[model samples]
Target chain A: MPRPAVEFWFEFASTYSYLSVMRIERVAEAAGVEVAWKPFLLGPVFLALGWNDSPFNIYPPKGRYMWRDLERLAMKEGLPFHRPSRFPRNGLLAARVALVGVEAGWVAPFARAVMTANFAEDREIGEAAVIEDILRALGLPADEVMARAQADANKLALRCQTERAAELGLFGAPSFRVGEELFWGNDRLEDALAWACAGAA
Target chain B: MPRPAVEFWFEFASTYSYLSVMRIERVAEAAGVEVAWKPFLLGPVFLALGWNDSPFNIYPPKGRYMWRDLERLAMKEGLPFHRPSRFPRNGLLAARVALVGVEAGWVAPFARAVMTANFAEDREIGEAAVIEDILRALGLPADEVMARAQADANKLALRCQTERAAELGLFGAPSFRVGEELFWGNDRLEDALAWACAGAA
Candidate 1:
């Protein structure tokens, strides 16, 4: 019998995604479930919804509340957080690199490092230098991975993955897919794991 | 000393509100916290954001996911649920009656009944007849409560409460306020209760 699994769809720049990326592995392992890491861009998804910017930035009141809510949630989860100096930093390069990690079996740690850089360490994950630093810190071949990550094929692959997310009816990141069921937000991680284990929840 | 309490701001028309309304009391009591029931309107709050309809209705994908998510959540909690034929039945009348209950000290039960009627029974919560039936089921004088709920003073109170919701920077329902900190969504209910108990989190 195949191990029950879930597809984790995440974007590097999403605050909520930061929460899930930081903890999904532990949660899934505890639930005895398997995970397929999927790195995708939310920019195209939001653009298709006619949003030129992150909805958090577009709606001020919601944006205000979200920052405070994220802070509280991070504290509760024992995670470090620093508000990003910039909102919705371009995740195109980081996502493409994550796509490279996906094939090489190191996506989870790489995604966590990138998320920590963007959300907790106040570093820009959009530039090659920052991403290269993350790659080297992971003791991976920075030169080789960076070359493949920036290649046209890897870039195209990230775009296709994003398109697949759209086709799956994803509107937000840190989303989980178990069969046809889709669970959105960092809060639903546990529920998605339960669905994965039980096949119905 | 006053019992540590959190203010629950909710709207009768909201699907997520149905989940919170039914479960808040049990959760709060378990945490040794008190709950102050707040019945407010989301229509005006959304209107201020230039949304004339429910964000779910305006955004097709989010709307599509919400109904399914709500069903799963309801099932998990052992709460009865049926998809309402109408997306957002005018919650005006129900909210007004809830305001009356707030003063009369029956708001919690009243809110739960209305929520059940709206989400579980597929009743039209907007109509006086449906609301009146709920009121009578609670053993209240339907005629007197309806009269008072519709009185100009009570109507003004609901308006002021909604304005307060906006002033407090609420863009959504099932919100909990612990003094200055505001927690949004039913998922945050437990966290909000913790804040009430700890005073800071």
Candidate 2:
């Protein structure tokens, strides 16, 4: 029997998601679970809380420790981690583009590439040109996908997804949903995958 | 030359600290770094941020994931972990008592014992009897130490230390400070110890 599928909800601008995106495939495979990529924006969710920025940035100590912790965790995982100069960057374009890719069945790879470019490579994922180049590199129609990503329906779907995330008690990025069980952060991916496999059994 | 001393700031109610407290001794030994235990209340720090409860509790997704992830991490680290019925328990008394222990040079053992009682034994560290029993078991003067813990000077000292933590940009428990470097979370203990040893060199 095939293992049950777990949804990996992520935001393009989230640092932890960058780590999750890099490792989810192998980890899920080892745990004998399938994964579905769900790309959404956290900015709208933060806005609903009446916050204009990342909570990490507002709390310096958490922010400082987070950066250092990321460096250490990345080293342990053998992944590249470069602290981005601008955090909580405008992920609007990235989110929209991710929606288009999800619709085109290229969400996982596109999301991973975008996240690596932003967190690991320190590239500006906010810029349309950067996202377009990434889409093209993935052998997708860059101009056509970019045009569809800017459509009213795609933007509205992204908003609806954000609302769904909030309703499901999600308050951060890099959250995974194994049926009704919600696991947050990159560190919890292994456990979430295990839980999903167990549930399938 | 001896390695420079590193401060291991912790809270009794923090789950991550339990893991750190359990493994810090061996890790610090390998890195040739000394550890000074610093205990303080996270309640006041939360209040300062205008939050009435633990951010994890307020954010259900994060909270649920934290508990589950902690379980997996504990198992992997060969430690016991079970979610306590009462969370965000009053850690003030424990913190104050830790202050007295620090002054008496029994902070490390006391901190470890308290953490084990809370996370492993699933006992309430907030209860006076539980704490007293722990101290008495260690052949310490429980009553006298508890009394000294309430002294005005000790209380003030805890406040000042917390303020210093805030100034240093700490937002959570299980943080380590080596000179000006700050490392957060149980996972960063190894790196923090290495940093301390390097600084001493």
Candidate 3:
């Protein structure tokens, strides 16, 4: 039987998604599960719920604890983590670029590289230069990818993806979808993989 | 110099708190840090934010992932876990009773016992009989505790604590405060302890 696949629905600006992006492939492979990278924007989703910004920033104590917790978790996982000065960075371009990559079958690698740049290296992902450099390093045509990312069709597709996520009852980033079952957060990666494996069985 | 203490601010109904409550003592002891249990209710905090129920329930994907993640984490930590049927159960009584125990200096054990009953035994904590049994098992006056829990002053105190939590900018349950440094969630327990111990130096 062909292995059932889990769709890893992620946003470029999500911190936990960075961790999952870096590790999900290896983790899923070890567990004998297939992963499909689904890049989408969380901005519209948050706005739909009347949130003007990330909930972590709106709630200070939770935000404070999240940073400290991330530090500990990063250390435990041996992943680099530094709080980016510009949080809730505009992820529209990144999402559009990811959409293009998905068409080109480079979605996973592009997502991982972007996540590493945003979370591990603490780079300003909103800067087109940085993203272009990431694309160039990946041997993709930077100008072509950027042009596609700015195209009206790509933008519309990104919006449609966001709407789809909301329709699926996803209010947060770093969510996973296996058939109709939706799992949220990097912590749920294991369960999502397990569910996908079970479906294969 | 007196060793600085880390305040473990927890909600009695928080599942993550159950894991921390069971293991914090040993972890803190090994790190040579004093842990002060600060029992508080998350209900008022939620209400103040215009939320009618647990964010988990309001956001189904996040809620579903949280339960599954909790199970995986419990297994990793070698702890027992069973999802309670009545989630977000009326924790008012539990919190009030915990406040009473804190005043009487039995907060730690009482907190552990109650958590065990809720998560380990999967008991309906909203039930008066179950709470009474827990209180009796702890060698406390069940009737007296229940009565005190309902008193106007205790109710006011609970409100005050929730207000203080908001004033402190807390967003969720299972937060920790080490001196002036606040760390939120079970994930930050180690950092909280380390910060507390460092302050002692």
Candidate 4:
């Protein structure tokens, strides 16, 4: 029989996504569940809600609370987290490169490295050099991967993937999906995995 | 030293607040913590953010996900939950009467009753009769309490409490505060209590 699977829908620029990406593999593996790393942009989803940027940026108080909350949560989780110099740094290039990783079976490490660089190290994820360095560090072919990720076909594939997220009624990340059930935010990770392990019964 | 205390800032109309209200006292008692229930309005807070109504109402997709999430969470918590016919039924009257309950030393039960009526029973909390019913059921003087709750002085007090919440940078309901630290959402209840017990060290 096939292992129970859960789709982890995340946006690279989402703080909560950073938390989920850093630890999902360990938890899913322990629970004997398979995880599919689905990278998608929250920009378009926010635009559909009449927001031009992360809601955390659009609302000052929420933004302040979010950073403090992240700091506390990261400390509790024993993870290194630094408030990025730029809020919602463009994840366009990183997300596209993530798709390339997904196809090559290296999505987990590449995605975690990107998140660590953007959030913990305050690097610009949108820059090609940053992404290429991450790829090269993983012993992957950087130039070839970048070229493939930038292709019209790969770009269209990412767009279609985001549309699927919208169709599933997702407005935030990191969201978890098992069959028809959708769980939003990093806090719901365990519940989603448990549901997946239950085989949707 | 006195038992560690935490202020639970909540709005009567918040769905997550319903979840928190149902079980906070038990958990707080077991954790050797003191909880001060502060009933405040979210309407003013949303207004400050240029929203005329609940953000859940303004954002349709979010609103949709919230109800489903509430249902699943409530079920898991062994709490009965019904989707109220109205979204964010005006908690103005309820908040005011709750202050009267606070004075009479019936705050906890009165506040929990209001939440139960709105969420588990699908009742309209905005109506005076409903408030009267809840107050009377608790063996409190319904007419006198309602009259006092309507007085200009009492109304002003509730308004001031809501303003205090905003001053503290609270942007939503079911938020817990321990000194300078603020924990938002129902998921953080235990963490907030733990922080309070740790005495801000």
Candidate 5:
């Protein structure tokens, strides 16, 4: 029998997504649930909803509150946090690279490293060189991974995944899907896990 | 010394505020904290942010997810759940009445009753008759309370409180203020309580 599982859909550029990506693996493992790390872009989804920029950027007060909320949450989780100089940095390259890692079963660590670079260390993960640095640091073959990441198939895979997110009616990132149930935001992580567990019963 | 207290800023029409309003007293009491009920309007706040409609209604996917999320949260919180036929019912009259309740030491129960009317019972609380029914159900003189609620002073006081919310950077309902620290959403109720307690310590 398959272990209780949830599909975690996240975008690297999302601040709330940073919270979930950092803790999901540990939380899921401890709860005896399997997590399917689904890296997708929120840009297209936002575009379809008629938002050209991050909603946090489009709405200033919400944006201001988000950073402070992230700070408090990071402290609670015992994670280091440094505000990024940029808001909603490009995640195309990192996401494409994550698609490659997914196939190799290293997506979790690769994604975490990219999130740390973007949110914690304020590194630009959009550049190929920075991604290469992350891969090499993770003891993976940076050159080969970069080659696969830029290839036609990986790019389209990300597009399809994003379309899937829109179809799932997702308006934001760090969303979790347990069966057909959708849970949004970092706070709902525990609830999603609980739902997955309850469904298995 | 005064008990460690949190000023709960809420809008009567907000769904999440219903969740907080229903359980805040119990939760705050258990934490040994005091709750300062501040009934305010979100209409002005939303307008200041250039959102004429509820963000949930403006963004369909978000609106859809919100109802489902509210249902899940209500179930988790052991509160009754029902979907309101109308979204974003006007809370001006309700807010004014709550201002009256605030002075009479009945704001907590009054706010909870209004929230239950809007969310759990699907009643149109925007109507003066419905609000009067609720006030009378609590054994208060409905005619006197309603008359005071419509008075110029009480109406203006509610307006001032709403302006206060905007000045505090409150873009949403069910926001908790501990000193200058602001915690938004029902999920942050505990965090706000903790912040209050921590500040007192």
Candidate 6:
């Protein structure tokens, strides 16, 4: 029988997504659960909900609590966290590159590197140069991959993937889907894996 | 030195707040942390957020997930849960009565009973009769307490408490504050107690 599996739906601009991407691999491997890395845009999702920007920005208190919560959570995980000057920095370019990386079997490493660069080093992952640097560091052909990522077909594929996410009733990042069971937020990672494992039975 | 303490800020109509209310006292007791129950209304908070109704009502997907999450969580705790017909029943009267309970040293029981009635019994907690029933169950004078709860001073006091919650940057229910460190959501109860204990040092 095939191993139990979960689709990890994440957005590059999501703070909780950064937390999940950094640690999901080890946990998934330990649980014998296959990880399907799904990089999608939250922009369209928010727009559908009548939010022109991240809810964190639209609601200042939630935004403030989120940054502090992220910092505390990162510290507990021993992961370096630096608040970016820009909130919800365009993850468009990074998501595109991550799609390329997902197909190249370097999704985990590439996603983690991008998150670290953006969240820890205060670097912008939205820039094509930053994404190119991430791809090159992974020993992939940056020029070829970048060209393929920006191709009309690949762009359309990402759009369809995001639409699928919306159809799945996803309204936030770092969501996990185990079969038909959906677990939202970074805090639900464990619960999602447990659901997947239970389903395997 | 006195034991470390944390204030548990909750709303009667909040689904997650029900979960936290049911479990927090035992957890706090086990951790040797003192808990200060602070019941406040989320109506004002949401209004200040420019939302006329609960975000769950505005966002169907989120609302759907919250109910499912609450049911699952409630079952895990061996607690009964029935979905109330109303999304967010009027918590105004309950909050006012809770303030009265706070001074009478019956805050925890009063809050838990109201949550159970709303989430587990499908009762309308907004009704004065329901609040009176809960108060009488606690052996408090239902008529007198209900009358005192509606006094102009008590009404204004509840308003002040909600305003204080807003000033503290609260955006959601079931929040915990250990001095200035705020932990939001039911999942953070354990962490909040830990933070309180650490602060005692």
Ten-residue region with minimum lDDT total, candidate 5 chain B: B1-10
- Candidate 3 structure quality by residue, lDDT tens digits, A82-186: 778788777778888999998899888888888888887888888899899999999999999999999998899988988998888788878888888777777
Q: Across residues B75-142, which tens digit of lDDT does each residue of candidate 4 receive? A: 99999998998888999999999887777788889989999999999999999999999988998889
Candidate 3 positional error at B17, Å = 3.5
**C-alpha displacement of B45 in model 6, angstroms?**
1.2
Give a tens-digit lDDT track for model 6, residues B20-79: 999998999999999998999999998999989998998999998888888878887998
**Could you tell me which 10 consecutive residues in candidate 3 chain B have the lowest summed lDDT?**
B59-68
Candidate 5: segments with Cα more than 4 A from true spot: none
- Candidate 6 regions exceeding 4 Å error are none
Question: Residue A80's C-alpha lDDT in candidate 4?
Answer: 91
- What does fnat come to for each candidate? 0.94, 0.71, 0.65, 0.94, 0.88, 0.76
- lDDT values for all models: 0.92, 0.83, 0.82, 0.92, 0.92, 0.92
Where is model 2 chain A poorest over a 10-residue stretch in terms of lDDT?
A59-68
**Candidate 6 chain A: minimum summed lDDT over ten consecutive residues — where?**
A92-101
lDDT of each residue in A1-201, candidate 1, tens digit only: 678899999999899999999999998899889999999999999998889999999999989998998998899899999999998899999999999999999999999999999999999889899999999999999999989998999888998999999999999898999999999999999999998989733
TM-score of chain A of each: 0.98, 0.94, 0.95, 0.98, 0.98, 0.98
Per-prediction interface RMSD in Å: 0.5, 2.7, 3.4, 0.5, 0.6, 0.5
Residue B191 miss distance in model 1 (angstroms): 0.3
RMSD for each of the candidates: 1.4, 3.5, 4.2, 1.2, 0.9, 1.1
Poorest 10 consecutive residues by lDDT, candidate 4 chain A = A192-201
Which 10-residue window of candidate 1 chain B scores lowest in summed lDDT?
B192-201
Model 2 per-residue lDDT tens digits across residues B93-170:
888999998889888788888888888787888899999999999999999998898889989999998887777777
Residue A42 in candidate 1, Cα distance off native in Å: 0.2
